[model samples]
Target: LVDHKQTALPALIEQLDSEERDHPIRKLAFTLRAIGDQRAVPVLIRAFPKTLLPASSDYGIKIEDPELKRWIAKHDLGKGRSIFSYLRAFREVVGALQQLTGQNFGEMELFGVNLANTESQRHLQREQFHQIAQHWAHWWEANQESHGVDPAYAKARVLMAGKKQGQLLDKDMRETAAE
Candidate 1:
């Protein structure tokens, strides 16, 4: 494990956009939280809803709540399984954002709607979270300067400023780690 905060932060940030299906997004979120950098707040907000469903599920499909509930109930994910496999990653992203910003956007209001036990309720909760992500984005835009976050990372409202598709991870960003 690399201990250099400079070397580690950008790599972790880049992983948030990893297209790899099983990319352990929750781990990345937790790692960012442990780093305790204000910089991670913006990126976390950017990724808040990227993994609301299992990787095996279609990332682009937009199923209505009623249909999603029927699908979840009919499939019978078995005794120990859940529809929340990857949704936990989204939760971790929320947790990291709150920790870094010292703000409570209301976890219950953001995620705890209806206990989410019913499949229909889970779908509704997922939609609520997507809306909450928007709230976080708006809040960050207004508060990033006060938190000492850079404008480049804040303005585009995404993970990295120059995030090249072919660029190597953590290659050039380390030099500015101390800043």
Candidate 2:
């Protein structure tokens, strides 16, 4: 909190887990954002296990071996060696939030989607991705990540599972979508 107003810390932390429930990073960021008491920049720099980091059942993402993971950890995320470090971009995320809310926060911590008007689509896509993820667990649980089930079929199965579980769809929801 650049302006050091940690009063909103709780609400901002809540937003971290709110982006999309399936968003592991968001949840991780929740803790990180809270750890520094809303000062998010340093929280990530200390290797705080934010998201998938070559670990266990992280819901089907590939887990590289220890050595490979170490190699990956040492390297920055840019494929084409750009000057911008992931951490820098991360700070920008926090900075933008402070600007948009006009809530002067010192010790700047970044959370949430980019508030850029262009990024409204980005937020929508992020939301849709969570919806898509609601399907994955069902597909994996029922079909074992697909035993001869093609991608399209798997997707349909996910929708069915999500609907059956009443995740984001109910009888009325289905009717509304149909209309």
Candidate 3:
């Protein structure tokens, strides 16, 4: 059996099925924290934020951990319950992904993101994502391996484009506007 400890993290990520990423190995790695092997550190770091150990007997991660009380007593994060540390942990994921991928991964929009108005998010109401999508086609042209990418979202984009192009069908309106 090949020892995964010696394997490159990128290769391990490519090899493991998504389920394997969530189970025993991920738990063990997080429990150990700094897994010492630099090659595996990237993979371990990616898993850390998501590894939800048994928070309490009641079992609801959204409810906050027991250590949270101790942290409040210390006043390190100020009063009133807020998920600041959780938000900060997310930045680590972004930082690591940026290091691994070069260029910012923040610009990329995954197909399955949760948003009330995905159309607006992808095009209309303006998120950082619209510019990313504008550039996505070009990125795809350059990288064939990205074919697994989700379908293009364009309803809001179409609306935004029409708005920008002048919301008038009249030839005179178009001509005058062009000038």
Best by lDDT: 1
List TM-scores for all candidates, in order: 0.56, 0.22, 0.24
lDDT of 1: 0.57
Range of the 10 consecutive residues with the lowest summed lDDT in candidate 1:
169-178
What are the per-residue Cα lDDT tens digits for candidate 1 across 86-150? 33565667667767887877754544333345777666655565555556666776788998876
Candidate 3: worst-modelled 10 consecutive residues by lDDT: 153-162
Better of 1 and 3 by TM-score: 1
Question: What is the lDDT, from 0 to 100, of the residue 82 in candidate 1?
Answer: 35
Can you write out model 2's per-residue Cα lDDT over 64-179, one digit (the tens) per residue?
A: 47664453233323223323233333333333323322334232322333423455664554444333233323323344332443343232211222133324433423443344
Q: Write the per-residue lDDT of candidate 3 for residues 101-165, one digit (tens) a residue.
A: 34453432432232234465434323332333333223333442333322321111111222433
Candidate whose TM-score is highest: 1
Flag clash pairs in model 3. Answer: none
How high is the lDDT of residue 168 in model 1?
Answer: 26
> Tell me, what's the RMSD of every candidate?
14.6, 17.6, 15.1
- Comparing candidate 1 with candidate 3, which one achieves the higher lDDT? 1
Candidates in descending TM-score order: 1, 3, 2
lDDT comparing candidate 2 with the true structure: 0.33
What is the C-alpha local distance difference test score of each model? Answer: 0.57, 0.33, 0.31
